[model samples]
Target: MVDEALRAARAVQSRLRDLPSRVVIYLILAACLFPEVGYPGVWRKLTGALVGLPVAAPTASALAQAR
Candidate 1:
């Protein structure tokens, strides 16, 4: 029982680790697919923000390095 619980916890942790990357990929795809609609300008701003130039380097670097 303990081993099974541990395995489940690890599995959950692993999936959580992957969630951010998957979300970012989905967001990028959405930006490409529905530009000028849902969040066209927003995605551009987000991309720019992530690049670590215009919006200050540290925060962008942290977000970029995440997941």
Candidate 2:
């Protein structure tokens, strides 16, 4: 899935950002799945299972700015 995401990101970032487009894409998709929860909650649920992996722990404002 991660590989797919990387491949899907054909566009490049204009500048260095804390959260990559792939992560934002998945995060938005996850938010759709769990609409009842806010971004912070969605982020927690997204990262909860992947405790072994290194992921961005972004803030609400950051998410809004990214989107």
lDDT, candidates in the order shown:
0.47, 0.79
- Worst 10-residue stretch by lDDT in candidate 2? 3-12
Quote the lDDT for 4 in model 2: 70
Residue pairs with clashing backbones, model 1? none
The Cα error of candidate 2 at residue 4, in Å, is 8.6
| Per-residue alpha-carbon lDDT of candidate 1 for residues 1-67, written as tens digits (9 for 90 to 100) | 5335546556323454423444455455656776664443534555564665543223333434442
Model 2 lDDT tens row, 1-67: 7647556775546677778777788888999999899888988997898878877778898886776
Clashes of each: 0, 0
Candidate 2 residue 51 C-alpha distance from true site, Å: 2.4
Best by TM-score: 2
- Predicted structure 1: lDDT: 0.47
TM-scores, each model vs. reference: 0.29, 0.68
